[model samples]
Target: MRLMRIGEPGHERPVLASPEGRHHDLSSVTADIDGAFLAALADDPGLVPEPERLPETDIAGHRIGPPVARPSALLCIGQNYAAHAAESGAAPPEQPILFYKSPNTIVGPYDDVLIPRGSKKTDWEVELAVVIGRRASYLDSPADAAAHIAGYAVSNDVSERAFQLEESGGQWSKGKSCATFNPLGPVLVTADEAGDPQGMRLRSYVNGEPRQDSGTADMIFGVAHLVHHLSQYLVLEPGDIINTGTPQGVALSGRFPYLGDGDVMELEISGLGGQRSVCRPA
Candidate 1:
């Protein structure tokens, strides 16, 4: 199922996108798409009631917000893709290198991506995000990671290279947590619908020009390994989001120019829908 939230920022309503390309309101069944709703659906897939088709005109003009409500944690994996790590002048880590993006960075898929104050190296990363459905801590094995995932979504891990490197005291979060730095989801597709998370094609474009083009198949540490590895250090609760890193092609590599005001960014994953954001000064 392709679940979503639609309306203005902070006032979105839960909806389900039908196979026929129409939207059906899911508010009657759940107040919002969040941890509780995900857990409930996991217990009983039939918990969602018959969807009421929304008028095409209304949906066509409305804004699309992040699929899930505010999550408890916004976690990220660094250099999970070998090619990406090489471009950044780093080697593949022996274990999953983790980082955090402040939950406040979350924004709608199509919202404007803010270029932070005094910023000059803002970059784009198209990644596949995993949403946790069940609580996980010290999992028995990587195979168990599947049962804990709610679904997957398209995530743009927007970054500020200068703040991340020169000014961050070596910590990456400083450059990753600016407001609206993470533009997530036009939809959160269920795991069943997303199929294999490690085989999807992820691509990014700036102002209609291709920038990053790669596949999850190139990931050095796949989704299951990251989840299991992370659970050993901290609890992965429902609604927690894990951004599984990007595959090469970003401004940080000096391959393309950094984002500037009025630049448009378009990102997509094969099954998880796409995102489009216009860069603007904060």
Candidate 2:
């Protein structure tokens, strides 16, 4: 099953997509698809009504919001893919490289991404996003990672090279935390139903041309390792997001020109659904 929210921003209605292709209203189950609701669902799966019992709803034309509302923390993994590190002209890190994008960067899957003022190095990154279902700290092992995860979603890790590389001195968050930089979700596919996180294929396109075509299997440090590794360093709260990382083929590689106004970016993961966004001036 997949959890979703549809309608205008700040006013979306919770929804659940069943395996049989039915979309049911989830408002009766929770106020919003947020940390509290995810934590409750983790504690009690029966809290949600059965698919057949909920009212079936049509959401064909409405806007799709981020499946989970503002996460308490929006964490990111850098250079998790070896090829991506090579493309960025850096040696593959021996351990996971962590960074943070402000939670406010979250926006709907189909929303417009803004080109930050005075920017010329905007780029696109398609990633598989992990949504935490419960708090975790100092996990015993990588195998324990799945239990704390709610599901997965597609994320666009939009970036500005100038801010990230030149102006920031050393830290990378400045280029990463701009408003509307992280475009996530059409829905969140529960872990049990999302198959193997490391087995899925993720891809991206800009204005109809393919930019990235790679599988998660290429990741140097897979999902479970990242989760387990992160828990040892910080307390991961429910509804926090971990953007596993993006594969090679971004503009930062110098193979393609930077993004400008009117460019369209479409990102997709095998089972997690896809996101198509337009670029506009901030």
Candidate 3:
């Protein structure tokens, strides 16, 4: 089922879209889409109520907030796509290139992405975001890692190239954590509904023009391996988010120019919903 949260920020209510297009309330089921609730939903499939009648909501009309309001951590991988790695003039890493983005950077779906003040190389990365469902540590294998996932969502890993590559002494996080950088969700699709995460077609468009377009097959490290690899270093807790890297075709790739104010970004993974945001001056 396509699960969503509605209402105002700091007051979102859980909801589900029924097969008949009715809005069945899951608010009666849970408070937020965090780790604990995810684990519970995983165990008790019946907890989510089927809405007899879809309720009217203004998700886009209301102030849409970040899908996961309070994620425990927001981890990201870099250069996980060989083409994207090559585009950025880097080699595929011997291991996953892991980094963290401050949770404060989280923003609502379709919100305007701010190009940081004094920035010139603002870039966009359309990526698949993994939301953790249960606590996991010392994963024995990639297959075991797959079971820990709660759902998937679309995300834009917005970057300030200058801060990410030059000003901050080469630390990618420096350019990655700008406020409103991680725009996530139109909806968080549960794992059962998001089949075969590895083969989906993912794309990014700026101002209605396509920029990055590729398949998840292009990923150097697939989801299971990434989860297994990451669990070796840190425990994967519920509500933690890991943004798998973007495919090639970013402005940094030179196929397209960098994003400027008023440029719009739209991204999608085949089964997951699409997300769109406009660029604006910081």
Q: Best candidate per lDDT, number?
A: 2
TM-score for every candidate vs. truth?
Answer: 0.97, 0.98, 0.94
lDDT of 3 by residue, 84-145 (tens): 99989999888899999988888878788998999889999989999988787999999897
Clashing pairs in 1: none
lDDT of 1 by residue, 23-116 (tens): 8887677889999889888778778665553433247888999998989999999998898899999988888889999988999999999999
Instruction: Kindly give the number of clashing pairs for every candidate.
Output: 0, 0, 3
Better of 1 and 3 by lDDT: 1
Off by over 4 Å in 3: 53-60
**Residue-level error in angstroms, candidate 1, position 244:** 0.1
Runs in model 1 deviating more than 4 A are 50-58
Clashing pairs in 2: none
Top TM-score model: 2
Error (Å) of candidate 3 at residue 129 is 0.6
The global C-alpha lDDT for each of the candidates, from Candidate 1 onward, is 0.92, 0.94, 0.84
